[model samples]
Target chain A: MSKRLLFVFAALIIATMVLSACGPKASTYECTDAIGCVTVAPGDPIHLAYDMVINGPDATLGIDSRNGVEIAIAEKGQLLGHDVQLTGEDDGCSAEGGQASGTKLAADTTIVAVFGTSCSSAARVAVPLLSQAGFVIISASNTAPDLTKAGDPNNWPGYLRTAHNDTIQGAAAAQFAVDFLKVTKAATIHDGSLYAESLANQFAKVFQELGGTITAQEAVDPNQTDFKSVLTSLAPGGPELIYYPIFVKAGSLITRQAKETTGLENTSLMGADGMFSPDVTAGAGDAVEGLFVSSPDTSSFSQKYNDYFLPKYQELFGSEPVSIFHAHAYDATWMVMNAIEAVAVKDADGTLHIPRQALRDAMYATKDFQGLTGVLTCGPTGDCANPKIAVYEYHAGEYPPIKVWP
Target chain B: MLRTWRQRITIADVVVWIIGLSIAFVVVYGSIKTIEVGKYNTRVWIDLTITGLALGGVYALIALGYTIVYGVLKMINFAHSEIFMSGPFTAVFLALALYKNGFWNSHPYISLLLVTLLAVTVSSTLAVLLERIAYRPLRTAPRLVPLITAIGASFFLQYAFRGFFGSGLQAYPELGFLKGTWTFGSIPVYKTQVVVIISALIMMLILYGFVQLTKMGKAMRAVSEDKEVAGLMGIDVDRIIMLTFALGGASAGLGGILYILLFPVVHFFMGFIPGLKAFTAAVLGGIGNVPGAFLGAMILGILEAVGPSLFLDGMGIAAPYQLKDAIAFIILVFILIIRPSGILGERITQTKA
Candidate 1:
């Protein structure tokens, strides 16, 4: 009996080792180019890196963006007759970690391009280093206006993004408040971060431009739980709409507090892309029933994304992709590969003479390239002039796009 | 001989004095300038102070836990922070379960009370168990061994929670009973803030009474003074140490619930910074000194919330707002450098005496 037990244990150990070795291997893509006369052999692997700090592992936003990148890489096959390799790092969506990760990526010569940094703060830290290193950085969800705008030529150069900046989204939100909701008086609130404050300011500016009277502008600490005072001060005015361009955590609390205090059952509360998540719905519960938000429509995007990449992602990660950022990341990988292919040249010696700087420049020269998000054309400032923004309303515990703004 | 030495201070003393004075001057000047600039906006100051105080109450509660544990064990309970974090996670889960059962939505106060009790009981029990499993065996081991083990335990608990709860921030449902604001003069005081301050003060008073008036408190004091001596004097030193950890853990649990009530977003690694700040407060208040920890927490809270607007505001420096961690660390360094023994630490005894 003892001999039999030892044999069984040894067999189990061997089986476990064999099963572990059979785990999914990293997928590779190869892009080959044939010169006028000769066919070039496969070159070195094309490296693509993605950086992001999701709210946590369960965040659908990061998953969606990551899935988008994976699909794009899979479709590219390869670059410059080389296998395309991809790696990702989490910046936790903070400025410090973003800078560190950006510096580390810049130091690595293997990395040709990067798709990342869903949060604007992360982009602010990365754009300078990556641009100086002549690497292409394409953000799927960074919407800070100052980043893409040529206002500070010294700061941003090779930075590009597929998502609409806060300028466009904020204006669309303001228009929705004025036209759809018919709100003449409005108040704006922000969490004092660059993303929140900038979007809030832009929304306030646009709302005022549209002949809407601005009643109040308040800044709350992001760590703060209570907004009773701020809500109370604005409650008396009974503004037709309260615009909040903050993240899910704070946004949910403010929504609940605003409803409870102001009894604003009819006073429309509007939010931006930051609050456009299922987490917000869960956090605010019934308080988010009538909440309105403006961002890229994800319902259509989710279907297309799942159709092409769901099987691959599931086979590897054992989970379905979540969030719109992943889709943008997938498109970003394709954009980089296309640019590399456009500039790569094969020499007589059977070696590929690809200048990274030339590839970066070609990325800027991309015109009318249709992407997963929308039609993309890299403008002079490296901002993709994708003018599609949709207004979503939380109904039946899901955010459904009510209107697509022009 | 003393007069000669005093008149001719060492160069090292001069350098230390300069560094300390410079930092103090900078902090003082910055705070004064910010307040002066915002003097016209009294409401901002009021708003800043109220927010600071509310957060300070929670800090004080957590700091008390660290101080009490340190007082008896003479070892930093690095896992205490994770204990604080677990309270909110447990409370939120309990509240959600109750809400789903139609118990919470109907009687919010009863649900809150029950959740608080549950959190305290669980946290205290976990604290005692952790001390026994992770630290008791290493009690006579090199001090560094237990300290390192404590840190490992902290990380273990954090990742364990993350694995169990899913890494996303879980939002606590709003309690209608804890909603609304009280207006005093032109300033608006949140009901949550009032509750946090009242509860913290009441808990502190009870703690102070327990330490000073109770027989178990006397035994604790004896153990803190000299564990072996207390054991020889008929005190169960081991029992006192366990009780100390339980008491501290209970306070931390209460703090966690209050924090969630205010912030609503609870996560796995949420206890890290707050734990560090609470530890800093304990050090600043003279670790083992309960009242001092409370004072340190209040000071740290005010500096965090009001420091940027009051000090950095005038320089056109928009507070990074996220640099609260940086601010807390700088204060901790300053305290260590200027007053290593803390604000109320006892002087070392002379062997000759």
Candidate 2:
């Protein structure tokens, strides 16, 4: 009877263990077939990978982040008294690019953690592959809410981002359009990508909730050059403002055509951070004048970034930083460096031992870490930075956009 | 009635019928819904018609190039769109230079005329060059050989243009005269649209006169009908073919400029869709028929402009603009299934045969 009771007890224990494994908690240390854990050995250099948009239309977003990461590495000198090496891969700012970059990075078990993915679409494919391999990915400028959160079914536990979510930017844009501009009728346009679509939807929802009527909601093909018909179709409704949060090319076309379109000339034109670049000004020429853009709060950035980093960056690169997210990238790199140091095990034999799981844990436990962008305290779902969205208005032939809101 | 229809139908016929019925259902359903929606009134309808006509005018000009090429070669010149693109992409530099020098403002008419002349000349030269280099060599090869060569040449020219003039989007300098709307009786027409429509119409008339009345046009018609027989009869088939290409190229270049005028943005990839729509217009009108291309383009432009709002908006569809491309292609499929020989049927081809 006792023996029978022991067998039953053992069976119950086994069942409990299996049940717990299948529970709601995300798998952390489990070595999945797709991605196995990587460990650091003595005298071996710690590997950090960067997957970002290095070429194509949105190259500025990635280039800025890469510069920031390089600066951070220069400041750190080394990690855990061992040399740290970075492998750069281009995400191309597309899903296929992300999958290709992620696949390449995952196959290399030496890489401890990744800092990347300026665009959210790239991160969507990359985070999962990195997560499965038990590698932590920290993004500098992935604003799509689902990248590091549960709302996106593909969200992995290994993904953490220092960038503020679109929820804040979208809401702030809606508030500005309604409260500041005092426009009650508005239309939102998206390019159907997760980044643009989510931001546009959020803006529409908030705009409607603020008692402003949403005149129209529209989506354009990213490849579409002409927006005249779409604009004309929406014109009779007489939207007071047209909020198009899309890329530079499409955004420029829309802005230029909106001014030229018969009924749409008086309608205010606004864009999101996707259009916040020199490219828009260059593409739209004089048409982009008086355009409003919602972007990350530049006023909150530390003066050190301006006084020291700016000149240093110009001196090193022979040009100004192309776009925003450089400071966020700098902050993300330091967080990874700090996390690595906190969990690193150094032995008397001149060998350093860095466990991948412990390093991820250290990153999540990050609190009150003073960074260039903000005082970051990583939340449960890996959102570290507080929301700070600002709106800027562009003047014709201007280099820096004029800040219009706090 | 169903049994009678089925008894007469072959597998191909049945397949076509199914596709036709499905398309008809969607279009009918959407149109009914749109008509019921009170938001779209007569003013909106009038505005959409103007917009469609302006777009169709440009498409018709581009379609002329395809019809001419097809008339002589009996092959679709897929690269003709790139030929159309090269003109406006190159003309922007002249426009920018004129604007900078204050010539654009001081002599707007002369400046516009000069820009058009440059675009037409360059486009004609490129078309002649394309014939000599890409098409001439492959003329004697299999039908597929020249077709493939045309496709390759199209991509090469696009990228080569991109390399020459950077990939960034270039905006045409805003003409002061074309800035505002020209209101005619409660209906307001944009100045740019008026310019595009009038210019396109004038160009089309000149082209029609050139093909119908000129000696070179007679030679082109002869080469298209029987190249060997025309050659035997002392007609220079090669020269006529090159001349035909030049005419198509000139028209395309002008079309590109008008396209830029209407939209005010120019890029290397600008010609691709317009080129495709022109080809569709050509096929819809009858590939070898010039007047048929014009008629088809007008129909296509109007349908694409008003179809979504008129058909889908009343159905309570969300973001109907997203399906605009689908609407254009659906019409293309309908035309192909219903009248494969196009609106003019094989009458144009039989004239040559």
Candidate 3:
């Protein structure tokens, strides 16, 4: 009996060692294989990575968006009883750079979720590789309508964005034009790029739907200097408003020219999220004084970001946060951690079991989770529908949000 | 001479002319078709003249750098583009820092002027140092050696800037003094456009005078014509070459500062395209010829500005936007194939032994 008991004890000890070796150490939840989706064991440290463009010309809001993500990640640590590590990748707001950053992150097995690609152009290139690799990519500001359209068969399962689609913003701008401003005749100009054209088309469709006449629609090259002839030709029968869906560089030039030729000081000029930067106001000077632009209001989360991340970001970057892209980057880190925590399961013998599909499903299952962008609930089509957008009027050399729309 | 001139229009010339005409016709036809389609509510022929002029200013500024260096060294300085790009990046950062510190808001013009002076000084110094360190070592080496060194230097500077800056678009803070629009009927010309044109013309005149009239400039020409003979005559060939690069670098730096004022976006790769375009301008104007480079830059700029809407868009090409680059290259290839000596290049002569 004593020899039989000794043999059983020895077998049990050997079994425990083998099981522990197969699983990640109990201290941290690490994904080792492609089998079952793994969740962070209770009291296990989780590593998360948020890849996004942090620096660049188009990164005005990117900085703020990243901060929002960081704040959420910090908050998650205090509430969820798990330590989280966050890392950022600068995509330079270019498609080529975005692809490289995506590839780099996907190759790193520790990065389970990615939060950025603030520009729709960058997102279009990054989504396929990240999704194919089974990493969840959630954009905080990508608002292209086709991205989440269920009608499109090529919809990515792992791709999502917290911002409202251009369709919604377009309709809102149109409504504001027709109902609020009571503008009967309007002209629309786009910078002849995907993002600009997409927003312009959506606005045109909605403007027509709301019984407004679009007198002129034109496409301008972004790199060109003189926009006089284009602006002159656009001046037919004196349109009451000009809807320009373009970025700051071209938009500033257009605004300055529009004011000079068309007396835009008397006419109301409106634009989309691309025009909502201090650079626009500065570049356009007093020409953009009355210009009204609409974008998602990230001001509510400013205090939260400052409280959690200002000291660290300032310590490193030595500047006050400029944009909201930073907030989105920060949230991307938390979202991945949340996914890892939800699906990671540990066996009795300390073996971690995780399936890639389960982590993806958990990302879809996220509901009513309070994120820095407000309460988050990703829809079946991978869109954060009904995000609140705000309109700001440039006055006294600053943009102050005047109204919030549903 | 007349018969030779007529026969000089070779098969290559005919092909180039035909291709150019065909492209022009297609663009005109497309514009008409687009108007007929009426998918767009408004159809307006965007004026190419103004765009061409503005583009020419940039081309002229960049071409001057190439021409100046080529005139002195008889070798293409491939690293000049990187020098140009560095100017804008530095200017933007300095301007921003100054703006943030309240210097710009108080005296915008003075601050900008100071920035420009600083940018020129820094760029000129860098240009001279680069020549002393990289090119001077390979001065007596094979001609290909210096050319290869130049290419390497260009790449090194580009990547080094990228690594240091962390590869994001740097948005320049606006200088209020440079903001305004001048309109001719429906045609609107920006203040930056005026600045670009005026600055380019002024710099070109100054450079032209320096090369043609100044003692140092005459010495540069003599060295360029025959470095060995000029050296024997007691002229410091190396010093002249260094001065030539410094002047070119200053011009490029000035161009960079103006460019950022217009576009307000700067990056490490910013110099690559502009550099190539500037080189094209140099060849177009007759590479070693200063006035020719100026003229060629203007023409090229105008072509780039007006070619898209007038030629490409008129041909029913949906996105004639990026076609500017292709159009420029096509022109470049045709010029090379048909007119190897360039539009204003001196004809080469052979002497019987």
Error of 2 at B20 (Å): 1.9
Give the lDDT ranking, best first: 2, 1, 3
Candidate 3 per-residue lDDT, tens place, A269-303, comes to 88888877776766666576778787766666546
Best by TM-score: 2
True-vs-predicted CA distance for residue A333, candidate 2, Å? 2.5
lDDT of 2 at B31: 85
Q: Which candidate achieves the best DockQ against the true structure?
A: 2
TM (B chain), model 3: 0.87
- C-alpha RMSD values across all candidates: 10.4, 7.8, 7.2
- List, residue by residue over B1-353, the lDDT tens digit for candidate 1: 99898889988788877877776786788777766665325555566666677778888999999999888788999999999998888788888898888888899888999999988987888899999899889988987999999999999999999888888767777787777777777655678888987888888888878987999998998898888999999999889989998999999999988887777778887788788888988888788888878888877877776665555545545423444556556766777777787876553222112
Kindly list the interface RMSD, in angstroms, of each predicted candidate in the order they appear: 5.7, 2.0, 6.0
Q: Give the TM-score of candidate 1.
A: 0.75
Alpha-carbon error at A113 in model 2, in Å?
3.9
Among all windows of 10 consecutive residues in model 2 chain B, the one with the lowest summed lDDT is: B344-353
